[model samples]
Target: MTEVKKQKPGNSVLGLFKEIFNWYPSSYPAAERKLLFKLDLSILIFACLCFFVKFLDQTNISNAYVSGLKEDFALNGNELNYFNVCYYVAYVIFQVPGMLLMSRPQLSRWLLPTLEVLWGICTFAQSRVTNVHQLYALRFLVGMLEAPVFAGTHFILGSWYSGPELFKRAGTWFICNPLGSMISGYLQSAAYTNLSGVGGMEGWRWLFIIDGIFTLPVALLGFIVFPGVPDSPKPFYFTSDDIALARARLARAKIRKPGPLNLDVFKRSLARWHIWIFVLCYICMIIGGYPTSYMNLWLKAEGFSVVQINQLPTVTYAINILASWLGTTLATIYPSWTIYTGATGGMVFSGICMIVWNIPKALKFVAWYVFGVSGCLSPILYSTVNTVVKGDSEERALIMGSMMTFGYSFNIWVPLLLFPTAGPNGAPRWRIGWPVAMTFHILLWAGFITSLLLHRRE
Candidate 1:
């Protein structure tokens, strides 16, 4: 039997620096190193860009709404929330089925990019919406088309990279979200200033139109650039030897090119404790991480102008990118359940700040800044789940889809239920929102500890 190697406790500070710069060297052969570089360039780049576009489109709606879409469409009384709900409804409905279908042999290559193009079109269509109902329908259509891509990309990442290599790649991929957030802020601000009424449209509408125009070419390139499922015929960039090395690495790790989806796959996956535990944990993640949404709305209510509203929340995205990198890097260096503890710390800080709203306005701003740091949790949590469920490709795919679906399922109602459209003194005051976020963060931390115990006991 092969012996399982244990990780060494390298100096934490030094290790963190290495992870920060991606300077730690592995002992792979020259051939494997070449293959890894090639994969990182060809696969990871496009995947990250696709993720950037995905998030840009999703969050731009909020930017557009606050900038102008709300007034133009006569939206009122939580219709903004309803627009988000519509997206989640379609997203949740299509997620698992889409992943299952995309998992079939030879389908992902064309299918995934095709869906990206379609969604890009749907996003552009949002520029044409005339009413709340029209906005809802288009967002729903975009959701359905966008559903499978994120989870599907996670599955593909697992296929190409082993556990240690995967998290950083996942971090690189997931950082696109913050990058997108930052870009959305800049884009909306620019559009509002430069593009407003340029050609007979509101600046917010131009945000959708211009962003959609940028998305089409990337989706087209994705068709040519995305590496297909691991076990498929090698791409033109990969020689036969590189293909052999790729499969051998995965095989040595016992990562299979999962066979056809079947009843047994579902049965085995769903019956596992990790699946349910991780799913519930992710649901809490979605709920606990809800405070960031109010950043812009609060600023708006506080009488920030259109540009200020779009530009200020970007501070959170900046903090988010830094926090995400630190969290994922620490996880890569240490490889422990303790990685999640960082997220819990940020949440606790945010909760305390919110709970004590009577503090000076400067402290309230600090609380909001720290609130952005919690963005790290989702990527780190995803990495942890991928590390635990590495053995089965089908199960990994299903679990990822299930986790996202379940999280989003609750998101369909949780925000409206927990967050008021308007809060006191132009602040979300969150009376209930902050406390609920705190409770979920506590629960999520406990779940991590519980999962750690269960894993160790096993």
Candidate 2:
């Protein structure tokens, strides 16, 4: 008899580690593993960088306001809220159109980077605003450009990755939001400390300039690295065989290729409960998490130094990053419903703590830190949407867009009313904001339950 060698067990310790951490299952062929590695290196890196810079640019306004924009503009009223409203309005207007445009592979690669460049220009322009009106105009433009980045990137990721591979990747990309915010905190602190008066500009102005500068290189890299949805033009880095493998994998997972976008696609998407339910759920999740945005303001009002105000909130972002990583890892291993349940419970607990509002300072800090659990929910929810709508590419794109559009549409008026900076209810414990946020968190839990029931029925 010929000598035979025994193969190692597939469930070896190293294989388990690979599946847990690398998203690489031992069951995959060597070729498939290689393909995933390449996709991760190129597509995931670009997506993470793009999202990271987007948040950096977006959150810088808050940092700038705290650093000096508030004083320099004499914004004692609700000008900051108005700035956000301008952005939100523009964001809502462009959100669906941008996602629809991104569905066409020909446009996505160019559209993403071009929009990035435009927004970078607009972000840089914010550095020179003489009045709030000018800043408002730039904010609108930046919002319009940035609206597509989140939903569109998710759409692209959903197109390329299967369900088993998606959550961890999505979670990794989603964490960049807090990572960007975390870095922005440190950056603003540094800018204020070192560059406050350089060239007769306020430190806040330098913050925008640096943020704008940071955006351009990443945008340029997108052109080189962004592989459009696998159906789009083949990327330079991917061999034809690689492209074939990608399409094959998605097909094997039963993910449909892009369908033509027309009235029926819209009709079908709108008629389905998926869009509405997900939209409502997303809106509640976002509104419920809104209180964390006021952390810096609260710290400032509590008589903290500017450095402390800027640096302290970073702890929340750090918690957010950790929560996202752990939550997504567990999600990959556990039942999908459990992820939402845990997130909803954590957020509800935080919401209750905020509504109580008279807790010890340390307990208050704990509430804010616990609130970071909200960071993980977005990836889980969006990944669920991707998996649920995998059969219809157009519907997936539309639902993603609608989720973002309707979710943000609330911000246009909600912040003005609940989280206002003027009138009787202002920042630093806007008495109404926490209570309202708590109510929304409760609603989010209901939505989670409804979603679970619906999924089971289907």
Candidate 3:
């Protein structure tokens, strides 16, 4: 038998490689590892909690769609699409501005948790929507509130983790969506089975209620222990030395990707083809990604029972949770390559799966597998930016803002192309939409190829 090599402390590159390329697990003691896991766990739980609320919000609207939401609101195809479109508008309008404002170490302390509460309040209010207009108004407000959550989380990681650590921890944050997917799925399922008719509430109504109700307290808890940049004042736990270590560590990471400093900085950064390159890259991602958002609806239309539709997102999420970490492990070494490849490749596989969606019921499980495995690809986009950029607060902020603004800004219109008017169903028949969407994989793959060329020079 072959023996494994010993690892040294502080070998970020080697450790990352071992995680991705080797078979043996780390030899850290279970006791110490458990304790360390708890440390990361405590921090991760809050981060995951914050993510859970918003990610649930992300797909719950679609979950509502097949859960008798249309019947409740009497929504036309265009009106329902408008409800979906409004959130992206809020998301686009606020993303860069929020990142800019939150770049401050201190300002984020207030804004991050506060939005959670505010968004939670809005989520609770969504339970009251009686019209497509009301759904649009509420969803737009929810997206406006959530704009800060993702970018804010990435900026916060810059203060805390090193390059090697970013992907795994970013995995921790992104994994929550898969978990949230599972949660939303089961909750949607349970509501359909047990609660949709109880108290005269529909499953969609319960989705908003349960999500909002869970979010409020978690947001409050976030205010208590969530860490900020080393410069900020905390409640009582961190010593001055701890703060100094935090700054020193961050300073080291920043040296690797130092930000542009002059007026030319703005010109230089914007002039790069990468801005448009990644924008197109993510546009393809969202094209494939938009299908997952409608999974509950799609499954319902395919004649799966309501219970199955409600439960499907969670199973998909569980696969995603595992895949998200695995994707991180792959990216820690290849950072951009792993995700860019995965996103485009996942679209292809997922597309092929859709072509076979009419396969036997036993084979339908393959669809979710294809769906779940790609969960980690999206987070790597932000992780790639975090891995590469270096600078003082403003330049760093601009880098993140520019990447994400372009990345997400296009999503607002993407849904229109795939799910445009399809008679009374508001969703296209799977046979029609799936093929059109699959063809988009070719475009996304082209984006990935170009991105790889650009990244090789960097």
Candidate 4:
């Protein structure tokens, strides 16, 4: 691997000021800036588009339920939770295997886009489900296919960008999570109003059809643009010199190239604290952030009109997008310690207000809105994992996949108990849910402290 000379830290007051506005230092070479631009256009933009549609397909089920699927299918029990359970189970099963496949240089380009295409077909098939069982099967397929996207994309990102650059890019990519959900809300609203009963299909069904259509073009584009990893065979868009510069940049940052994914890799990963600690952190953050998904169900219980239900919760996503941007920017300027503490702290506050459940209507609204900040934690956490495991590519991929696998494996049962739809504790004020969420948020703080100590000792 080629190694570039390390640039001096921009520690002056002026340098600090510049960082707030620019992602790269003013002292960076013009060629490096051009390289960043190319990477952003090819890798970052495509990653965002792919993730946006993945979430759009994934979240549309909730939107569809609230729109008309619940009534049309007469879903009276905890069927929504069952659907989520099905998806989570498949996702947990496939998560690690998918990441391992993506780790192969020969498979990286083909696997991601092919998975996207298959999932798109499944997403489209959901529109034709006449019964809940068919919908469950389709959801399982979609989840299995999408299992690789988030973790796999992060692995690809870690291979190309260094620590300082990864957060901004990862955070930017993560914004699409909320963005896709936000757009699904508006899309459902529009379809319900304008396309209801068109071709004798419910507006909710149309949502799936439109979302499935969005996935295909993006997946096709990925085959053309995705550059795999820096050490892998280069795409036509990048010249040899460009690939060398990318390697030099990562080398200077002390990021090692790919090591064989053998028994030794698994042994080394398990022996380290990185995998265990980071997995716990991810689980806490995910579980703590669960109640936000129920905001629409709460609105429905409050007797809001269908259109209002669809549009109102989008504000939460908007807030989430802003919070994600602010978190990334702050991490860029100050210590990332701020991101860990600040995001979990916000979720804890929101969860407290929710658990009380008797607060004013406006206060409840504020609680739901503030919960948006929790969405920022995922990118920051994943980026930290990438940095911590930088010396071993296979280990990094394994840890990331394991984090999602264990995290969602918990979700398979956790949500059924905590956020059940049939119990007295269900919906609007999920009595058990909010308190449980708050406790996990506190646990995330512990994880943060432990990670800090581990990093220092290393």
Find the candidate with the highest TM-score and give its number: 4
Question: TM-score for each prediction?
Answer: 0.94, 0.95, 0.83, 0.95
Candidate 1 lDDT, 19-74, residue by residue in tens: 46652347677788898898998788888888899989988998998998878876
Task: Give the range where candidate 2 is weakest over 10 consecutive residues by summed lDDT.
Answer: 1-10
Worst 10 residues of 3 by lDDT: 1-10
Selected candidate, larger lDDT, 2 vs 3: 2
Alpha-carbon lDDT, every model? 0.79, 0.84, 0.67, 0.85
- Tens-place lDDT digits, model 2, residues 1-458: 00011123246767545556756767789988989998899889988988999899878999998899999999898888888889989999999999998889888778888898999999899999999899999999999999999999899899989665787888888999999999999999999999999999999999889988989998999889888788788778789999899999888878898878899998898887788888999899778777676689888878888898889998889988977777766676666567767877887787788777788999988888788887778887888788778889989988889888988999888888888876667776678988888888778768756775676567
In terms of lDDT, model 3 sits at 0.67
| Poorly placed runs, candidate 4 (over 4 Å) | 1-17
Residue 124 in model 1: lDDT? 86
The true-structure Cα RMSD of candidate 2 reads 5.0
Off by over 4 Å in 2: 1-19
Task: Give the top-scoring candidate (lDDT).
Answer: 4
* Rank list by TM-score: 4, 2, 1, 3
The segments of candidate 1 whose C-alpha lies over 4 angstroms from its true place after superposition are: 1-16, 23-26, 423-427
lDDT of 3 by residue, 2-30 (tens): 01122232458666555664322355444
